[model samples]
Target: MKVGFATQDLKRVDAHFGWAKNIAVYEVTPEGHSFVEAFVFAGDLQEDGNEDKLQPKLDAIKDCAILYVAAIGGSGAARVVAQNIHPMKVNQPEEISGLLDKLQDVLKGSPPPWLRKVMGKGQERKFEFEEEV
Candidate 1:
């Protein structure tokens, strides 16, 4: 699954969803993770209630299964959830690589129900039925 990190330095999930200057994306699997791409933003990125700043960021992470951020506004979180993306808020700044590692570890184990749901999004569902003999 794909994961997004809101960062200013691109090395940590240390920025708010609306104020982040860089949004880095990575492909994370139980085996490992790899960097996919990044979205860079410029100009004013303050908490001024400007909803327009969110569209590009949302579009950037549209395919991501989860997003890690230091903080996110209520509206931003709502929008993210509406898009079927899980937004995770960190109490403090965290290393992006470390977060990825933890996610990989969780994938190797039995992820929680919410995580499983997020991971299963866009995947084909299989069902088996028995015919009367």
Candidate 2:
């Protein structure tokens, strides 16, 4: 599946979803992953609360299954979700390659339901949570 990452230095996932000047896309599978390409944001990176700044990004990652962002506005997340792309917010800045490896580990192991969904396990998963009867 394709994964999109928001990064500023082209190495770490430290860029905000709406202000990411450089977005790196990677193709990840159980075998491993590879760099696809970088999507440059030509618009103003300082602009905030504007969907126009994020449109190109959404378009660029239309085929992506997951998007890793340092931060995302509610509207931006909604847009991504509408496009069937799962959005993940990174708590801290980390190396993109390292994060990818972690995802690989999850893929190789017994991934949780959410991870499975992100990996495109199946459409419309049935969620079951234990509750007080």
Candidate 3:
């Protein structure tokens, strides 16, 4: 399954879903995982009144089974869930590599029901970042 990490520095998952400028995606499996791509935020930073700001981010990561972030606004989380994308909240910034390692271990073993569901849906087609709006 493909997992997306909200990160500002590429080395760690330290950004909120609404504020992350870059998101790292990876194809994860029990045996291993590899970096798939990074979705760069194209929308404006000042999102004060633009409720639609989450659209682009959603479009970019539509293929991901889940998203890891430091935080997510209630509405944004709703939108993600509405799209069938699972949102995971991390209490603190975490190293992307370490996180992936732990996830791989889970993948190697028997994953919980929700995770199994996400893995099952991971085969969906992905939208090209540049081609899509």
Candidate 4:
């Protein structure tokens, strides 16, 4: 799956989803992860409710399964969720590489239900008790 990180310096997930100067994308798997691409934005990106700026950012991560950010607005999060992209918020700046490693570890282990859903394996299972005789 693809993952995106919102960062000002492209080193950490330290920027708001709306104001991030750069969005670094990576291809992640249980084996490992690697950088895929990055999207750069300029001009005013402050929190002023300018929804237009979000389009390009959305386009950048259209194929991403997850996004990491320091913060995100309600509308921004809604838009991301509408696109089937999961947004993760961090309380403070976190290294993108560290996050990737952790995600890889999770992929190696038993990921949570939501994560499995994001990984495109969310099919509902019917247990024996639920099967109609």
Candidate 5:
């Protein structure tokens, strides 16, 4: 199966999926439960309010079975669902290893409603960041 993680710096899971400059996709083999191969999408930063920014990520979703993201907007979420790819909302953790561990279960199937609701809201992280500091 294939999985995609929305990330920034191509390493850490970023706070927001839309704000991620890149996405790392992995091909996981059921045999050993390991990532057999990987790919990266590196390109222009998504422009705020620019709907076109999601095209690449949407395109990437076509090849992956599941997508793990920090946060995603309503339209993006809808697009992902329409593409038949399961979307899993993952909180940005301090370590990627820990985050991956937590996601292991979620990757098994569809995400719960709470997560769906959050993604449907399309709330941008910039607002949350402003509230934090």
Candidate 6:
């Protein structure tokens, strides 16, 4: 399975997805993962409003099973989801290594609370837990 990560600098994963300055795309194989190939392109998709600029990067990630991002706007989030690739939000670790370590846990078919709420619609209010004494 291939996995993509959006990082500010190709070197590390900071707290915020920071800026989209670079994207580190990795192709994971059964034997092991390949070296993370860095895509050095401008990350100014928001101001530019040019989705076309991202087409190539998105194409390179077409085969990826998941796209890990530190932060993504609603539109970009929707774009990734439309591609049928699972989007996982990471807390922006200090190191980029060992990122895939949590893949199994992340892919265990449990949606996050916010996602569940969104999917539940009004029913989400019914599932709210009461404060414990």
Per-residue lDDT tens digits for candidate 4, residues 1-133, read 9999999999999999999999999999999999999899998999578999999999999999999999999999999999889999999999999999999999999999999888872335555666678
lDDT of each: 0.95, 0.87, 0.87, 0.93, 0.63, 0.59
- Model 6 agreement with the true structure over 49-105: per-residue lDDT tens digits: 666766766776666666677766676667777776677776645445676544434
Model 3 agreement with the true structure over 33-123: per-residue lDDT tens digits: 8999998876574475577778888887898888999998898899888878899999999999999999999999999999988887746
Write one digit per residue (lDDT tens) for candidate 5, span 35-128: 4334354555556777787886787657666677788888888888787677878654334545555555554557577544433333344433
Q: Highest lDDT: give the candidate number.
A: 1
Q: How big is the RMSD of model 6?
A: 9.8
lDDT (Cα, tens digit) per residue for candidate 1, span 30-108: 9999999999999899957899999999999999999999999999999999999999999999999999999999999
Model 3: colliding residue pairs: none
Report the CA-based lDDT of candidate 6 relative to the real structure. 0.59
Residue pairs clashing, model 4: none
Ranking of models by TM-score: 1, 4, 3, 2, 5, 6
Model 5 misses residue 116 by how many Å?
18
Could you tell me which residue pairs clash in candidate 6? none
The collision pairs in model 2 are none
For model 3, the stretches where C-alpha displacement exceeds 4 angstroms are 122-133
List the candidate 5 regions with Cα displacement exceeding 4 Å: 33-46, 99-133
Using all chains and alpha carbons, the TM-scores for the candidates as numbered come to 0.94, 0.86, 0.86, 0.90, 0.62, 0.61
Task: List model 2 lDDT by residue over 1-133, tens digit each.
Answer: 8999998888999988888888899989877999999988776777776667878889999888899999988999999999988898889998998989998888888988876766772356777999999
